[model samples]
Target chain A: MSVVARLDEARAARRQKALIAFNATTLRLGGKTIIENLDLEVRPGEFLCIVGASGCGKTTALRLAAGLYGPTSGAVTFDGEPITGPRREVAIVFQDYGKALLPWRTAAGNISLALEASRVPARERSSRIEALLRKVGLPGHADKYPTEMSGGMQQRLQIARCLAQEPTTLLMDEPFGALDAMTRQGLQDEVLSLTQTSQTTVIFVTHDLDEAIYLGDRIVGLLPHPGRIGIELAVDLPRPRDQLATREHPEFLRLRRQLFDFIKATEH
Target chain B: MNRAAILWRVASILVAAGFIAAWQLIANLRLVSPVFLPGPDRAWAALVRGFSSGDLASKLIGTLEHMAYGWLAASIAGIALGALIGSSRMMRAYVAPSLEFLRPLPVSAIIPVAIAMLGLTQGMALFVIAFGAIWPIMLATIHGFAAVEPRLYEVARSLQMSRAAVIGRIALPSALPDILAGMRLSLTVALILSVVCEILAGLDGLGQWVLLSARAFRSADLFAGVILLGATGYLTSIAVSLVEQRLLAWQTAAR
Candidate 1:
C-alpha cells in the first residue's frame, strides 16, 4: 500500500475508537416518531456537525448525546458506557442564551455555579473563573449580569460556563443561530479554535448550511419524517480553517453545494 | 439628582402643602362639623396630646408588635409551603383547589371565628393576621416558582445539581422578586388585619384607640390615630422596597 493510504487507514482506525455512539436509536414522543433507527459515532477530539432542515431531529440527536433525552429504543453510549443521564464529563451549550442563563447572577457568579456543581474548592474558583472568562473573550466581565451583556456576550458567557465543567465532550444546540451574521461567524471561529486547543470532542447541531461546512471536521445531514442520517461528508480541508480561504477552497465549495442541494431536496 | 427628579420632588411637597392648606381652610370655614371632621390644628393637638400622654405610643407599639410576629410567622410558613407546592405537580394539584376555595373568603369574616376559638386574646389577633396574610405570600411564591424558566431547570440538571441544591440555589433566587412582591402586599394585609383584629377584639392597639376616641366624641384623637396608621403603612412599604433593591440589584443592573 502507498504511504499516504497507510496514514489515512491509521487515522480512520483512531476515529473508530469513538468517544460517543448512538446505536440503532429511535425516539418516539407522544405516539409520533421523532427519530428512527439512527446510528452514528463521534470520535474523540473531533468536530462533528449535524445539519438538516427543520423537523429533521438534529437538536434531538444532540440532546440524546447530552443525555437530556432517553431513546425509546437502542442506547447512546459515551466512552464505551451507555449514558444513563447527564455526566459531568459532558456539558451542553444551549441556543437560547437569554433563557439559559440566570438573570440574577453576574458573569463570574454564573461560572461559579458550574464550579460549585463540580465541587471545585472555593479557594481555587476565582482564578479558574478568571481564566475561563478570559478564554471566552470576557476578561473583565465578572461583575456584569447576563442581562447587562449583549446577545453575543451572553452566548460567550454560556460557553464559558460550559467550559468550567471541563467536559471531555461539548454538545451545542444551534448555539450561534441567535446571533447576528458577523457575531455568529466570529463565535463560530472562536469555538473552533477553543475546542481545537482543548482537544474537546464536540457534537454541534445547526440548520445553516455554511455553518455546518465551516465548523465540522465531518458533517452529517438528516432527512425529516422519522429523522435519519441521509448524507455524511468528511471535511478533508487542512487544519486552522481561514474564514476567507476555507470558503474559497474548492473542497469547501463542493461540500457546501452538495449539502445545499441535499437540503433543498429534503426540505420539500 | 437630575433636574426633572428635583422638580418632581418639589412639586410633590407643594401638592401636599396645598392639600393641608385646603383641609385647614375647610375646617376653619366649618364646611363640615368639627365633630365629623377635625381641622389640621385639632389633629396636630391630638397627636401631641397622645404622645405626651403615652396612650398613642403604647397603642402603636401594641399594633406593631402583633403585626411583626404574625407577619414573620406567615412569611416563614408561606415560603415553605409555597416552595413545596410550586415544585411538585401532585402537591400543587391537591393543595391548589383548597387554596382557591379559601382565598376568596373575606379575612374580616374569619376574625369572628378566630375570636371564638382563641377568645379575644393577642394570640387570637395574631392567628387572624397570620391567616389573612399567608395567602398572598404563598400565591406569589407559587407564581414565582412556576414562572421560573424551564431552561434554567435544564441547566441545573445538566450541572448535576441535587434536588436540594436546585431548590436552595436556583428555584429560590428565581422566585425571589415575586416572593418579595408578595411580602410587600402581605405586609399591607398584615397591617390591615392587625387593626381589624384590634378593633374587633378591643385589644390595646391603635385600632382600639381610634375606636375609643370616636366613642368618646374625640374626633381629633381619631384623626391622629388614622394619620399614624397611614404613616406606618407607608414606612413599612418603603422599608420592604429598600430591601428588595439591595437583593435584586443584579436584575436592575441588567435592565
Candidate 2:
C-alpha cells in the first residue's frame, strides 16, 4: 500500500480522539520547572508551528509531544492513551542538525533502518526506501554517507528517514536551524507543499518568526522560562505556498512583524 | 632506476661494513679477546653450524609454539574481559582502579611466583606471557569504548538498534583501529617476555642457546643466537603490522 493509504488507515482507526493532547502539563528537569501547566492539542492533519527564544522550553514541549519525555505532574497523550515512551506513530527530527544518521550505513540503508526495525517485507523495502528518498529530493544520492552530504542534504535525508515510518505525526525540533537563510526558505516551502499534499500532522519548532509565519497553519508563540502559550495566531494564507509570493504577501509580512513584536514585548 | 639514490644506498652499506671490519681488526690485534668478540664471518659460520646440527630448527619451533599459544590465550582473555568491563558501568567503575594498579607491574616479577607455584615448565612461561600481553588489548577496548562519540551512540539509538547490536555493529567496528594498535604494542612485549622466561628459566629455547654460548666463551654462537632473536622479533612485528593494515582498511578508507 502507498504511504498515504497506510497513514489514512491508521488515522481512520484513531479518528475518534485528538491525535495529541498535553493537559495542564509541567516538565521538571533536575527540580527546575521548565514548562508548567501547559495545555496543548494537535488535531489530525494540522500544520502547527511552535515559536520561542532559546531555552524557552519550546523544544521541551516538542519532546513531550513526541513521547520522548513525560510531564512531571500532568499528562501527555496520543489518541487519548498516555504515552510512556516513543512509539512508531510519532517520529522526531532533532535540531542536532542531521548528525543522527549511522555513518556506517549509506543513505539508503539509513532510511531503510526503521523499516527493517518494523519488520517490513524484504521484497518491498527497496521501493519504499527509494520512494522516500525521492520524496525528499534525494533520488540519486542514496549511496552517500551523511558526512558526504551537505547540511541541507543531511536534513533532507533525516526527513526521508522520518518519513520511512509513515508516521501520523512529525515532531521537527528546529530541524532547519543550521541551514543557510536561502536553503531554509526552500526547505520551508518543501515542508509546506509536502504537509499540504499528504495531510500529515506536523509540530514544527523554529527560532525565526518569519519562518513560523511562512509555513504554519497556526503559530504557537511561547514565552521563556516555564513556557506557556504566549499567543496563538492563525495564518490564513493559502496552501501550496511559493516562498517569494507568499512571503511577500501583505498578510505574511504583517503577521511576521506582529509575532516578532509579541515575542519582543512579552519576555521579561 | 634512480642511479644517484642507488649509489648513495651502496655507499651507506659500504660505510657500515667498513666500521664492522675496523672493529674486527682492532679486536683481533689484542685490543679485545676473540672470546669476547666475533667478526661477521664467524657469526655466519656459527649460524651454519647450528642449522646443520638441526638443533636450531627444534628450538625455533619451540619458541614459536609458546608465542602462538600465549598470544591466542591473551587475545581471547583480553577481549572477553575488555567487553565485560566496557559493557557494564558498575563493573567498569570497580574494575578500573584495579586494572590501573595491576597493569604497570613488571611481567618478569611474576616469574618467580609462577615458578614457585607451577615449577619450571612451558605452562608457567606461557601463562606469564599471556598475562603481560592482556593489558594492552584490554586498555585498547576500554579507551575505544570511552572515546566513542556520544553522537554515534545517539545515532544507534535513533536507528532502533538493540544495545548488543550497537556494541557489535558500531562499537567494535569503530574501535578496531585502536584495538589493532594495542595488539601491535602487546605483541612486541610478549616476544620480549618469551625470551626473558627462556633465559631466566634456562629452558631449552633460543634464550638458553644464548646463555650456553656465553658460558662456553663461543662469541660467534652468541652473535648467531642474538641475530636470530633480532630477526624473529623484527619479522613478527612486521607481520603483525601487515595484518593490522588489512584488518583496519575500513578505518583508513573512512579517513
Candidate 3:
C-alpha cells in the first residue's frame, strides 16, 4: 500500500515476466567447463549489464542468452520457452566490429543484411535501413564501407544493423571495448537513449565498472574459473541519464565502487 | 599513379626492351645460330605474315574459345564443390583425400589418359584444361572459406539466416578475394594446359602452329608462335587482374 511496497510489487511482477533467464546453466567448451550452475533472470525492458575480469565468461553467458551456444546442461529460456537457437527477435552486437560487419557491404548494405534476414519486404527495406541509420546517428553514411569508417562510426553502424532486426532484446558483447573514451561515452548515451526509446531489453557484457553502472538497470558480476554470478546489484539511477551528472551521482558512484571492489577481489 | 608505380612501369618496359635488344644483337651477330633462335625482327616479320594470311587469327580464335569455355566450366564446378567442402566438416573429411590424391598428378600425365578416352580430339584438350584449372580454384576457395573469421559465422547464425543465405551472402563474399586470386592462378594453368594439349595432340592452335613450324624448319614462324603464346598469357593475366581489381576494389580501399 505504501510507495516502497508498491515499487517492490512492480519489481516482483517484472521478475515473474522475465524476457530471458538462465536456469542452472552449465556450459562446457573444448573439454573445459566454461560456465557452471549459472542462474540469471532478465526482466522485460530492463537494461542489464554483466561485468567481470577477463575470462569470467560474461560474454559466454550473453551468448547462452542469445542462443548462439547451448548450455552443456540446464536451460536458457525466453518468455518461458526454451531457447534452442538464435531467434529473429534476438540480435547480437559483437565486440569485434571489424569482423562483425561484412567488409564488402556498405553501412546501409550491412543494415540491409538484418532486414533481409528478418525477411522484410524489399520495398520497405530502404526506408527502414535509412531510419535505422538515422537512429544510430549515421545518416548519409549508408554508402561508406565499415573499413572506411572510424572505430566509433563503425560501432554505431553495427548498432544500426542490429536495430534493423527490431530485436526485442539487444545482446552486446563488449561492443564499445575498442572505442576511445570520448566516443565510448558518446555511444553509451546514444545506446541508452535508443534502447530507452525502443523499450528493448538489453543484456550488455562489459569489463568496465563505470560502464556497467552508467548504462545498466541492474548489474551482474560473474566470478571466473567456471563462471557463475557472484553479485547482483540493482541500479536505481534516474532515467534520461546525463553523461556529466549521472556518472557523478552518489548512487552511480556507490555502484561503480562496489562493482570495482568486487572485480578487484575476484581477479585473484 | 604514385612515383613508385610509374617508376616500376617504366622499369618493366626498359627490361623488356633490353631483353629484345640483346636477342637482336645475338642473332644479327650470329652469336647463336638463327635456326636455333631467330632474331626479333625475323619473328616479327613472320608474325605479320601469319596475321595477313589469317592463319594466326583462326588458330588464336580456336585457342581462345577452348580456354574460355574450359576456364568458365572449371570456375563454376570448382566454386560449387569448394563451397560444399568448405561448409561441411563431414564433406571435407570425405572428399579431401581424393582431392589431394588427384591434385598432385601432373596434367601432362592426364593427357595420355584423356587421349585414350577422348581420342586426341578437342574434347581431350578441353578436358585437360578444365581438370588442370579446377584444382587451384577449389583449394583456394576451400582455404578462403575455412579462414573466414569465426565471429562472422557467429553473426550469420545469430541473425538466423538460412543455410543457403549464409553460404550465398557470407561464405561467398568472404571467400571472394581468395577466389579471384585462385582464378588468376587457374587462368595461367588453363593457358599452359590448353597449349600443352594442342602441342601433344597436334590440334588447331598456336601451340600446334609452333610445333609444325619447328618441324618444317621455319625458325621465324616457330619463334613468332612462341612469342604470341607468351604475349597471350601475359594479356589474359592482365585482363583477369583488371577484373579482380574491379570486383575487389573495396578490399583494396579497405586496406
Candidate 4:
C-alpha cells in the first residue's frame, strides 16, 4: 500500500469510531438488572441489528439508544454527547404500531405530527406530508385513518411518520413482528432502501435471525437474564440485497445459523 | 335501519301509549280523586294553557339556564383538575384518597349545606347543581388521562414533544371518549340537581312551578310542569349524545 493510501485508510478508521455508543451501560428496573455492564458502538449510517431471545432485553437496549430510558450505572451517547432526553434528529418506530399511532388522526395528520413537533410551518407541511406518504407507498391514502388501513399499511404509515423527522438515526423495536410473512418481507426491503438512500443509522431489534442477517451491516446477538451481548458478526453480504439471492448467499446462511444457535443456547 | 332497531322503536312507542292509556283509565274510573291524580287530558290541557300563556316557557328557560351554567362550570373545572391530577403520579397519590372519600357522599346531602352558605337564591341553586354534576366528569377525566396507552407517551418522547403538547395533543385526544361518557352522566346529574335546588331555593324554574301548583291544589299544572322537566332532561341528554357521537366518530369507524 502507498503512504497516501495508508493515511486515507487511518483517517476513515478514526471517523468510523461511533455515532451512538453504550459505554459500560447497566440498566436496572424494579430492583432487577435488565441490562448489565454493556458496551456497544454503532458506526455512522450503519444498519445494525440486535437479535436475541424473547427475554433478552433487546427492546430495552433500543429504548436506551432512543434516550427514552436512562441507564442506571453507565452512559449512552450520540455524536460524542451524552443523551439526556429525546432529540429531534433521532426518531423511533415502535413495534405496536396501533398503540403508537394517534387513532384520531388521519394518515396525513399522523405524519404531520413529527413535522408539527419540529415546528415546520403549516404551508410547507402539506407538500412535505404528500412526499412522505408517496415515499412510503401510501399515496392518495392520506385522509384514511390508521384503523382503516391494513396491518402492513399501518406499519408503512408509521415509517412515513418517522421519516418526516428526517432523522439521523432510526430506532426500530421489532416493527415487523406483528406483520404477516409476505408483508414483513415487503417492509424489510422498503426499510432497507429507505435507510440506504437517506444514509440514516439504524438500530433494529428483532428475534428473527434471518431478518437480522438480511438487513444488517453488523449483527449483535444478546443473552437473556441480565441481558448482555453473546455474539457479534459482521455481515459481508453484498449491498442492494435481493430477498432471494441475498438469503441464498453462503455468508448469509452461515450468519443465520450462528445467530439461531446463540438464541437457542440462551433459552437454556 | 335494521329489523331489530325498527322493532325496538315501535315497542317503545307502544309502551308509552299503553302507559298514558292506563293513567287515563285510572282517572276516568275515579280510583283516585281528580285533585290527587288528574287525567292525561287535563295534564295535556294544562301544558297547552301554560305554554300559550307563556308562564311555562319562562320557567323552562330559567331551569335550562341554571342547568346549562352549572353543567358548563362543572365541565371546565372537572377537566382541568382531572388533567392536572391524572398526568402526575404525585398528584394522583395525594388527591385520590380525598376524592374517593368525597365522591360517594350523596350530592343531596350537600343541598342543605349549599342552601345555608349561599342562601335561597339562584347562586345557591347553581352551586348545588355544579357540585352534584362535577364528580362523574372529573372522575372520568382522571381515569381517561391516566389510562392513556403508555406506548403513545413513548411516541411523544421520541418526537421530542413538550409536556404541554403531550397533554394537549396526546393525552387529551386519548382521554376524550372517557370524558364524553362522564359528561353525559354529569348532564343528567346537573338536570336532577337543578330541579332539586330550584325547589329548595324557591327559584323561578319548573321545580318551583310544580311545588306552587301542588300547594294550590292544581294537580294538572303540577303534572304538566313535571312532563316538561322530563322532556328537558331527555332533550339535553340527546344533545350530549349527538356531541359524543361526533367527537368519537373514529372509535365507531374502527369497529
Candidate 5:
C-alpha cells in the first residue's frame, strides 16, 4: 500500500483544517507559462516539501503561496482566504538568507528588524529575540553582526529572523540548498524540531529528492513546461527521526529513487 | 586613529617644515623676490597679523554664511530632483540630456551674469556655488538608486511594506553612502566657486582679500589669504567626512 493509503488504514479516518489550498492555478510571465493547473491542499502544521528541476516554477509557486504576487489565473487560498499580497500570518525564508537578513544589523537586531517592521511592542520584541536566538543555539552571539558569523549561523539567524513574525505558515525557497552538508544537516534538524514546537505549516522547495523525502510530511513533484503536479508522495516515517536512521531507511531510499526517476524522466 | 599612524603623520609634517625652511633660505638669498614670493614664515606672520587686525575674522563669517546657503540649496535641490529622476526613467530621460549638456559648462563662466543680476551680493555667490556643486550630487544619487540590487526590492515587495515606507527605509539607507560620496565631491565645487566668485566681485572674504592684496602687490598677505582659503576648503571636507562617518557607521562596518 502507498504511504497515504497505509496512513489512512492505520488512522481509520481523518479531518483537519486546510492551511493552504491552490485550485487550477496558472502562472504566466511575458507569454511564458510557469505553473499550469496546479491544484493541492496542505493540512495544518504539515511539513510539505516541493521537489522539481530548475525553471519548473517551483519558486514561482512558492511566491504565489506566500502572496508576494497573486496567481495569473485561478486561486491560492491561505487559511481559507484568497491571498493577495504578503500576509502577516505568512513569512518566507529565501535561498539567499544573507541578503534577506539585514547585514548592518547585529544577529539579535537583524531578527528585531522584522519585529520593528511589524510594530511588535518593544519589551516583547527583546524577550522574543533573546528566546529565538537561544533556541537557535546562538545565545552569546546575539550581539555579533551577520558579517562576523559563519554560513551556518547566518542561515540559522535567517530562520530566527523569519520566526520573529511568529508566523503560522513558513514558505522556504531552497533555504538549505546553499549550505554545506554538515551545516545543512544541523539546520534541517533545527527547522524540523522548531516546526514541531511552533506547529508552523511548512511549504519548502528543494531540488534534492533525499532532502524532500527526509524533511517532508508530503513530497510534491512538478513536471516542466507549464509545470503541473506530477506526483504526491506522503512520507509516513515516524517522528523524532534520527538523521542516520531516516537517511538509511529502506522506505526513504525507495521514495528518493521514485522522485529522482520523475525528475530524470522529465529531461527526456 | 593610532599611535603608529600619529607618528607617521608627524614625520610627514617635519618633512614639510624642512622643505619650507629650504624655500625661505633660497628666497632670502635673492634667488626669489619677497614681492613676488613670500616664504612660509612671512605668510604665517601675515596670517597672524590679519587675524589680530580682524581683516579675516569678520570676512570669514560672511563667506561661511554664503557657503552654508549654497551647500544647503544644492543638497535640497540635488537630492529631491535626483530621487525623482531616479524613480522614473521618463524623468531621467527628459532631464539627463539637459544635465549632461549643463554639467560641462564651467560654473565660473556664469560669474558675469550672476554679478549683473544679483550685483556682487552674497546671494550671487551662493547661486554660483550651488550651481557648481549640485551636478555631482544629483548624478551620484541617481546612480545609487538605479544600481540597487533587484533582490532587495523583492524583499520589500515580499514584506508588503507601503511604497512610501520602502522609499523611506530601504531606498534612503541604501543610497546614503553614495550620496555622501557625492557630497564630498560637491564640497570641492562649492569652495572653488565661492573663492572664484569672491575674487571676481567686490567681496569681504578670504578670496576678496587675496585678490585685493595681489593687486596691491602685498605678496605675504596674498599668500596668507591663499593658505587660509586652502585651510577652509580642507576643513570643510574633513567636517563633512566626520559627519559621514558618524551617520554611516553601519555602512563603514559592512565594507
Candidate 6:
C-alpha cells in the first residue's frame, strides 16, 4: 500500500475514538455567561471548525479544549479523562502570533521551548527543531527573532513551535485572522496538508465562514449572547481541497451561505 | 560615524575646551582667590601628585570596593524579593502598602539609625549603601515582572512548564530590560551612598579625603577628589550601559 493509503487506514482506525469532548460545558466569567451548554465531541483525526460572530465564545471554547480554561458547569475531557490543565499532548496556535511568541527568543529557541519542556535530550533538539521548521516552511530561518520576522513568518514559526510538541490535537484560535487574504489562503492550505499527513485532530475557531467551510470536515456555528451551538454542517467537499475549485464547489457555497445566514440572524 | 554624529562630538569637545579656557582666564586674572578657586592646572597637578605620592589610589579603590559590595548586595536582595512579591498576587497585596510607605523615606534619614545599630564601621557604611540602593532595583523588578504579557503565561501553561520554569525561563527574561534599567539607576545610588557613608563613618575613601582636604583648606586636593569621583561615576555608568547593550541586544534589534 502507498504511504498515504496506509496513513489513511491508520486515521480511519483512530476515528473510532473520541479525542476530546465537551459534555454540556458552560463557562461564566466576571458574572457573565460566556459559553452556555456547549455540547461538542471531536473524533480523533477529525478537522472541527467553530465559526461564530464576535462574543460568541468560540475562542473560549478552544481554550477549554486546550485546558487553558475549564468549563464552569460541565466536563471537558480528553481521551475519556477529565482535563484539569493543559497536557503536553495538545498544542495551541494563538491568533495574536506576535504576543504568542517570545520576542527574546529566536525561532529555533522558541521551538526548543517545547522540546525542553518535554525533556527531549539537548543533542536531539536541534535536529527536531530543524525538521519542524522545515515542515512549517521555515527552513534556514531559525536564528531570526519573532520581531525580525514578518507577520506570516512569525505565525509559521508559532506553528512550527506547536508542531515540535508532536501533539495529537491542535487547537487554533483564529491563527490566521491577522494575515492578508493571500497569506491566509496559503496558510489554510498548509494547515490542511499538515494535519492530513499527521492525522492530527484540530479544533479551529474563526469568524470567517468561508475559511470554516474550506478547512473543516465538520463545522459548528455558534450564537452570541451566551454562546451556544446554533448550526452544524458536515462539509462534503472533496479531499485535498483546492482554494479556487473547492471554494467554487456547489456544496461549499451552500455551507457558506448557511453559516453566513446563521451569523446574521445571531447578530439580530 | 556619520556626519551628524561627528559634528556633535566636535561641538561637545569645543564646549569643554572653552569652559576650561574660561576657568584658566579667571584664575590668571585673579577674579577669584587662587586658594579658593585654583586654575585647572593646579587641580591636574594635585591629581597627579595624589595618585603618585599620596594615598588617593587606595582611597579610590576603597570607595569602589564599598560601592561594588553594596550594589552587589542590593541586586541580589532586590531581585529575590521582587520576584517573590511580583509572582504572587497575595504576596503583592500583603506587602505593597508597607513597601510604598518605606519607598519614599529618605536614605539619609536612616544613616544615623544605621550608624547607631552597626557603629561607625565598614559594616555600617555597607548597610547604609545597600539599603539606599536596593529600592530602585526592587521597585523596577516588581514593575517589570508584574507588567509581563498575560499571553506569555498562557503559552507557558499550554507548554506544561513547571512553576519555577515559568518564572525562570519566561518571567525573568521578560522582566530583564526593566531589571537592567533598575540596576543602572541603583548603581548611581550605590556610589552616592558609598561616598556619604564614608564621609559620615570616617572610612578610608575619596569621600573622607575630600572632607579632610576641605577642612585643611587644600582646594586643589578637594577639587581633584571631586573630579575623580565624577570620573568614577561616568566610567561606571558607561560600563553598565555596555553590559545593558550586550544583554538587551535583542531589544535594540527588535526596534
Q: Per-residue lDDT of B70-187 in model 1, one digit per residue for the tens?
A: 9998999999999989988788889999999999999988888888999999999889999999999999998888888999999998999998889988999999999999999999
Residue A111 lDDT (model 1)? 96
Off-target runs (Cα >4 Å) in candidate 5 are A3-17, B1-7, B251-255
For model 2 the local lDDT of residue A131 reads 93
Evaluate residue A11 in candidate 1 and report its C-alpha lDDT on the 0 to 100 scale: 56
The estimated TM-scores of all candidates read 0.96, 0.82, 0.94, 0.95, 0.93, 0.96
Off by more than 4 A, model 2: A1-16, A112-116, A119-132, A139-143, A192-196, A266-268, B1-58, B202-205, B232-255
* Each prediction's DockQ against the real complex: 0.85, 0.33, 0.80, 0.78, 0.50, 0.80
DockQ for candidate 1, C-alpha atoms:
0.85
**Model 4 whole-model lDDT (C-alpha atoms):** 0.91
Per-residue lDDT of A199-264 in model 3, one digit per residue for the tens? 999999998889989998888899999899898787888888998999899888877787888988
How much lDDT does each candidate structure score?
0.92, 0.81, 0.89, 0.91, 0.83, 0.91
In angstroms, give how far residue A230 of model 5 lies from its true place.
Answer: 1.4
Best by DockQ: 1
Q: Which candidate would rank higher by TM-score, 2 or 6?
A: 6
Label model 5 with its docking quality class. medium
Question: How well is each residue in A1-268 modelled by candidate 6, as lDDT tens digits?
Answer: 4435644654464457678988999999999999999888889889999998899999999999999888899999999999999998899999999998988899999999999988899999999999999998999999988888899999999999888888999999999999999999999999999999989999999988899999998888988889999977777779999998999998888778778888888886
Candidate 3 regions exceeding 4 Å error are A1-15, B2-4
Every model: Cα RMSD to truth: 2.2, 6.0, 2.4, 3.1, 2.5, 3.9
Per-residue lDDT of model 3, residues B54-135, tens digit only? 9998888877877887898899999988888987878888989999899998888888999999998988888889999999
**Taking the tens digit of each residue's C-alpha lDDT, what string does model 5 give over A196-255?**
888999999998888888888887899889789888777878787779999998888888
The per-candidate TM-score of the B chain, in the order shown, comes to 0.96, 0.87, 0.96, 0.97, 0.92, 0.97
lDDT (Cα, tens digit) per residue for candidate 1, span A171-249 = 9999999889999989999999999998999999998888889898888999998999998877777879889999999
- The candidates score, on chain A by TM-score, as follows 0.95, 0.91, 0.94, 0.94, 0.94, 0.93
lDDT tens per residue, model 4, B135-228: 9999999999899999899889889889999998999999999999999999999988888888888888998999999999999999999999
- State the weakest 10-residue window (summed lDDT) of model 1 chain A: A1-10
